[model samples]
Target: MIVEHRIYTTHPGQVHEYLALYEAEGLAIQKRILGRMVGYYRSEIGGLNQVIHLWAYADLAERDQRRAALLADEGFRHYVRKITPLLAGQESRILVPAPFFTPTWQD
Candidate 1:
């Protein structure tokens, strides 16, 4: 499996606005298309105003297809428009687990 980890650094003091938007709108659209959410988190210490979320995919191909669908969704597009200005930076990484340690959760 592959894990996509996305970290969004919001404009200072805007984390709450981003979280509220995601919770009210983005989360449902994402859950409908990007089904394998590992977790969602917000930074409280070192990386203040950062939001981190993880999604697991069987492979890169599946990730691409699902992400494409998400991008096509009207609700997602609208949510993106509203949240774009609140972000300071965005980073994403695709992770491959080592043989000795793999995630136990099943999608």
Candidate 2:
């Protein structure tokens, strides 16, 4: 499996607002479409105002398909409209687990 790491850096003091909006409006639709979420986090020390989340996919093709579906979702689009103004920057990365590593969590 491949993991997609996403980080959304919110406007200086907008982290709370962004998180609240995500929890209320974005989480459900995103979770339903993405399938596997490895982790979700907030930066409390070094990178204040940043939200980070990890999603797992079977492969790049699956990632592409699901991301495309998410973009087409009206609910996600609505959430995007609401969160766009709160964001300062965003980043995404793809990760592959090491040869000796194994996931412990049940899927």
Give the runs in model 1 whose Cα sits over 4 Å from its true position.
none
What TM-score does candidate 2 get on C-alpha atoms? 0.96
The TM-scores, one per candidate, come to 0.95, 0.96
Error of 1 at 28 (Å): 0.6
Tens digits of lDDT, candidate 2, 27-94: 99999999898899999889788999999998999999999999999999988999999999999999
| Tens digits of lDDT, candidate 1, 1-107 | 99999999999999999999999999989999999899999999897999999999999999999999999999899999999999999999999989887677855
Top candidate, metric lDDT:
1
Clashes of each: 0, 0
